[model samples]
Target: MILIESEFPIDWVISPLPEEEGILGNIFFISRDYMQFIEGLVKKYKPDFVVEDKGMRSNEEILSDEDEFTAIFKRGGISYRMVDIPEYALNYISSPILNKKALIKKFSGEIEEYKRRGQVHYNDPHFQQLVMWYEYLKEDLKAQEEELRYKIRESWMMMGILELAKKQQKKELTAFFICDKRNFDGIVFLANELDITSEIINIKKVAKELEEKNSVEEVIKSSVLEIMPIKMKKKEKIDKILYFFDTDEYCSPFDTNMGYDAGFDVVIPYCKMTAERVAKLIQDAMFSRKVGAPTVFFVGGSDVEESERIAQEVLKSMVPPFEYPIIIDPRGAHTTASAIVAKTLEIAKKHGIKDLSNKKVVCLGGTGPVGEIAAIIASKLNANVFITSRREEYVKDLAKSLTIKAGKKAKKIEGVAANSDEDYYEIIKDADIIWSVGKAGIQMVSKEIMNKLPKNKIVVDINLVPPYGVEGIEPNFHDEEFYPGIYGIGALDIGRLKYKVESTLFNKASMTKGKTILDYNVAFEIATEVLFGEIIKISI
Candidate 1:
């Protein structure tokens, strides 16, 4: 059934289901959620095109295989639009685009092609070694090629579809893979060692062979000592050059060893490749365990347009299933945001400033995540938090949300929305602590404002720009108890926290056997534990 609403309709449409021959072209059927989302987009945006997700199936085909779908529409007539399915359409579509029998046939055809003698070739001895290695790996991996492929696909689909959804919404997205550092380091070390060992062996053999044959001495003796003064023969062309010491070319046995040593079983091939594989392993474990809710965070942009590029890059790096909290904090925004606020509170309490009961904390660019988080944290600490933004509307809405999120304590959250230098200076005058969390090059608070503040006031600028947001604080400045009465911190202070937090989270995640959600609470708890020195240092 076609759902219609009128306000602003979607401009374009894309169909993920592949088109087939026969009677399935005319019909469009999709899940209720997809349909609703489309309906909402149509009503709100009045977009020129809408991608229909479901296509038709022939009655005859349906009778034979109830799961089959025919073909997709070349174009959506009238108000509708049709576009090619994103490459991952197979996973998102409700019904199979190709029949099971046809799929099998196609796969068999591929296998047949690979079976051709010329198609897959290696030295016989090498091939045997590879086969033995494959068998050994298979025992450990515990799955056949097909099963592994399926797992990768499932994981990729889970990751890719969410990314696709974000693309539809035009939101910023990021994808990353995490792995055991030890494993990767191990591989690199092993590969390098093998290469070195082989080189040394080959070099020693050649040098020993060369050193034993003293052509120079033999020639001198034959020419000078013989009664007939027999002239020594010229040296052989091969012996004229010292090839044993040549390190320049792949002809060296060492370089050849490197190729064998650096394969997948070695250092995971590449950092990104290893990350992708580890991500797949984690995803599969989660899928099998089925214990936790999964979340993917697309942090930076409000719309999907710019974020799609980053998302696609991440997806390509992953094998199939790219699953995890893919948070895109452009410029370390969210990570920095969460880290600074959390760290400041801990440091403050440790410094004997117990209660912020009546103090005012000013956050520049407070509408941004970092500034906003600072405000939230201050409010939680019972300190009055003042937020600033360039746009009044933005600051107002952000403050309201924080207020709502903080409930009764949100009343303590105040804000000023200004777009110019004068406005920025005026906002920080009463600030007990001034936080700078804005664009890279922009200065939120001037030196004049910093001077105007009470000598005892805390001026902590997280900005690392040359002309920092708070003007005077240098990027390299860390506690060192700088400025007598005034406290200061730079980007590095927060960076340390970020690294520790990430390391701890990675370790915690590694220990989890199944799919696990890395949620706000999880991050929060982990951060707190790090602050309290509860978590043990991870070796890798």
Candidate 2:
């Protein structure tokens, strides 16, 4: 958890005498004069323990209410400790203070004495000033104690709400209480005032507007701005990275909320993101964590170009030799596409699906994006390949350009007309294997065509629509032998291969130094490794 303490109020600082344990959570106090505000904040931000800075005061200026500075963790069974803030962490987010040396000397001496002897007598002169501060706040002290109790109860409720979020499947609910920064001066006073409590409240109205399911930017624009501090750019910090592999489809903000609900110290979303805007949005999500580590990113979106750019930008932002963990391709398209075809070739010999020596493999919709790549992989595997497109001219042009790029003989490349199922069948009938790579809804193979396949024919479909590319085929179809005793592969089986390859590549990607672009070959190699059982099972 990345802890953010915008400012710490000096006046509210009090050296609590340990009844059991010192406060142990992080504190982000912002004002000194408003005791009421501090009182409320202490409850609202009721940390595990606090590293409090008790202020210097004359004997007459000290608060005398022992109850005002009550320690109720014992009664509630909550252990907390308050210690002096470390200078390194303090420099980044702490408030300015006066007479630092004197304060350090005073507190350090007390800490040393407390550590040296288990018991420090209250009657000792060293404890006199500490006793005076407690006495000064004693008049209003009882009310403060009540406020602390209320906060502990509220913290328990907050934890419960988080638990409920985890139990609920597929929905994300994030809560934030926004208030005016001007009112910050009266934070301590506000804590004392009951009326101000409700003003800074839950995110009901904002959540309602977002529930309408508009875009993320719209919700962010409509809800709150106080949380984002302009001019607070000390530097764009990249804390750490989290990876999600082969499960990008189900990876959404709601999924991220689930992680937060589960009490992850810091949950950074980093899978299935495919857009550039998502990269920037992840940068913003870094602000939410507030206890351990620095601000990190949550990178997930559904646009490929954007995801690529984000990968680039994130690498650039990281320190030299970047070496940050980034997880992409969990959705399984870019990585899986290359992997499936490559793996097929690796196992082709064992399956008796051989003879790439001048044999042609027709890729239906070959000019289409995925088909084009499938053709390239087949060509690289030493198969003479013919690519077809609805528009014959486009197929011709693609083959011509690819011939040069691949450094293969241009004569091995061939193009033909294929605008519909009939044209598709005519072009693929003589080929050894038929690879279907088209839009989800388009059906290319019929039952009659299946019965007509050669005895040793091999067919692979990468479509995941309602009706499988070949009728009677299930998405997760698995059998020792496929349709009519001819070898066949379904979409989900390929999807599993895709997932395994994706997870492995993402794990390896975490080690990349900077500006690494995962290309077709990277996917091809990973898929080959997965087919050979060189990689572990893919994660969801």
Candidate 3:
């Protein structure tokens, strides 16, 4: 789990014992004001152990930018001992004030700077008044800084002492709440996020209780946040996914929502993501996790090759033992291909064709992403696959590339040109499955060609626009025996399963362990399992 503590609102102040001697007017817990911002970061970043400490050093104001000061951790990198702050637990408790001498020594420069910028002339009474005001503010800031430092030291020592106590007594950090203010919404929100009982104990009460406790063990056992994340459940994983879509537009709500529906606890979508950006994102996601992390990656967009390149970069970013599964579905092609091939198998089985091994499958528009993937999956079923294009050279090149990608299944598939009517007739003459993967409204296989083609065969047209990709099958048909003895599955039929298949794969990405890539073959397996195989529950 990665924890990203958002920017601390450094303006929040609490006046405790206003007339108290030595210490400053109010305790400054500048980091505690952003309850909502912190919560949002916690959810979005999915951090395991949050570090909301404002160490006494004023590092947030000086060493880092406001955004940079807000902590961002990759998964499994939550041990933030580098901060070296007191364990800030009970509602923004800071240190006691410094002496007047220390305040002057600490902020003399600041006081002078204020005097230099004052409104009146140096000799004027108003200038004197302005100088006095600067002195007052400087002293106040110095005192607050010292007091915050004291609390920080106390917290650090308390944490060390308490951890030793826990080891000695075997007590859990979950057993305590060390807070100063009970009714503050910010306090309550933090308390709840930490999964503690919001008992509303103020820091003052907590401090008093600490003083009364005789043993160091007793003091730490009762402090929340300060005790460190004790006994975090090693099991029971919550999955998160980073989805990078490379397009001018950020991302469609459809896919992102689908990720959530598929069981991801949080789905962070990034748009217009480049290969370089994806590399960094991959590094962050993978490096943030330890063993059995539920975080994963999803790559998608309209540009097929670019998305593929980014996905490849993501895969390459992971070294052995520290990697997450990635799914590549450019323009919904992977899921679409899975559905198209799965439907063909379904239709074949209905006609008493149990095995697809002997089937002759021909895919029109073979050069396209959808067609190529469909050809690959169908070939995996041992079907004799042939991809056709108007250009013989293009068909051959697509077939070669698809062949390389499909590996052993390459032997079962080939490509040919089907530019003319005679070519289409000859191609579909012995085809058991004819898929029109051409662009929408461009009819490849017409009614006449279907009439001449062999019967008891399946024809699938995944084009919603008219003139349909395939000549005879209706664009709106889900599954109608539009042509006798030949079952035609339309675009909508494949589309429905396409959505289901993608969600199923996402669920698999979250749940599946070890090294696994969810692509067309995996998608097909999941789709078939959902429809016909053992009753696997698919959420969407």
Candidate 4:
């Protein structure tokens, strides 16, 4: 039966017996003092839809409103707009439109009385006084037509109501007076999160066009969602990652170790797969988790750009606050980038620098994952960071992406082309620190450029492969000063910390019970926390 959670006390529309499928509903109206406990009612009846009779709303508004619905259904596993029962949608003719034309006709008596009073009330008890009383009375009749004239237009709420009714097998939908918008909105919001099956319908327009209701029960004798499917009650009480990689290597043993070291009990690496392939696998794994079990996803590959796109697809598969968390650290970009930033801070601290404010830091080779992530982290640290590339277009694109990803730091970051020795000299004129996280074997900041930098500046190189990431920094150099007074960290220096940072994040995720989006920023946070002895969690 339909459950009308009316705002005002309702007197109309009696509920037909359970046997009568049509016009069957229990009314909770009249002094809607009980409206506050509507959630209790929703829990009690689990109604098809809480039919709110009187309210005005738009589709966009319904989509934007989610807080109330979430608050109402505190727990998960709620299916709203549960099924596509288009049969009711097609069959039902609106009672409002059918009775509208005849309504004005019924008021003919009062209308005539109103006219008669206009003519003869010239001297009742008092002519003007009688006229004023009748005029006020005329307003009631006017309001009647005004209310029914528009007919019933289906807002997003109404369409969802019928579908939900059908899904719950509460096919009896007879509606009322004030649809507080909250009930309608809340139901829709909860349903969306729970993945309710619904189809859009214009019931109001149908009521306007169709003059008569279909008395037939159902011509198709079919069903939509008669019963909700059985769900897994047990949340997989463990954290897992179907760590997908694009390369044939499946995954790096080092990366897999990082996950286990962080907090995951198991890390299953599947290599050489496309986004489409991995998306399906990911969905399967995420769905298998028990109710309270937490899962974290990790996406890593040499192709940082493509990995980010894959991460987007992974996100599309998740139901927020319900699904497991996902982290995109493609090609160790986020990890290494975070480590680079932390190392920079350490160097700054050593030099007695208070903060990076107004400090100029030049990031060489800003097009790679490490470069972009480094730039983002630096910007967050309040550094005046300059990200350079061989081409202006790549710099511009990275600049735009960084601006959005890094927020205010994006403003402090400017993209420049540092292809030539002259470009390097001009860009690094005011540089206090330098980070060279260019592509493997690419000579980004040559000795010519390094020689031009200030004597006391800090420089870091993150390219571990042959040809190194920077000009003067050795691969094994930790925090060593080879360039006069310039302190620097080499590839191994950042690599060791990158491993630690990633491990710390994983461990943090393991300990966390709720969803935690572990990214470069989170990595940097854990890194800094580890440095200050604030982080106590240690994964074996």
The number of the candidate with the highest lDDT is 3
> Which stretches of model 2 miss by more than 4 angstroms?
1-238, 242-332, 354-357, 407-413, 483-485, 533-540
Best-performing candidate as measured by TM-score? 3
Per-residue error for 479 in candidate 2, Å, reads 5.7
- What are the lDDT scores of the predictions, listed in order? 0.45, 0.49, 0.64, 0.60
* Residue 159, model 4: Cα distance from true site in angstroms: 69
Could you tell me every candidate's TM-score relative to the true structure? 0.40, 0.44, 0.54, 0.52
Model 3 misplacement above 4 A: 1-239, 247-252, 272-276, 288-293, 475-479, 534-540
Report the C-alpha lDDT of model 3 over 207-277, residue by residue, as the tens digit.
33455666778866874332111122223334465454555366867778888888777788788877777
Output the TM-score of candidate 1.
Answer: 0.40
Q: Report lDDT (Cα) of residue 207, candidate 3.
A: 36
Candidate 3, lDDT over the whole model:
0.64
Q: How many collisions between residues are there in candidate 2? A: 49
Tens-digit lDDT string for candidate 2 (1-540): 111232332332323334354353333233232333334545665533322222222323223333333243333333322222233533432222223434545665675677598766767675666555444444344444334323332333234334433554534322222223322223323332322221232111113345564788887677542322222222323433443321255566543553344333345544544444444544443334332333323344444435556656665554433234444332344565575575456545566665355667777666655665566666666677887777778779888766554454323567777766677667767777767776787776777776666555566777888666665566665432566555666788887776665555544554444335555567777776666645322211
Tens digits of per-residue lDDT, candidate 4, 1-540, equal 233333333222211234334352332323222433445545654533333442222234334444354234334244432111133432253344335434545455554676786754545655555455556545654564333322223234445554555665543432221233224334444444444432211111011222343543432233221211122122223435435455435576777877776656678777764567766876677667665465666778777767777777777766655566667677678888878877777878888876677788888887777888888777776778889988998798778777677774244578998778888888876788888877778876677767666787888887777687667788778668877778878888788888888777766665565444667867777777766655322111
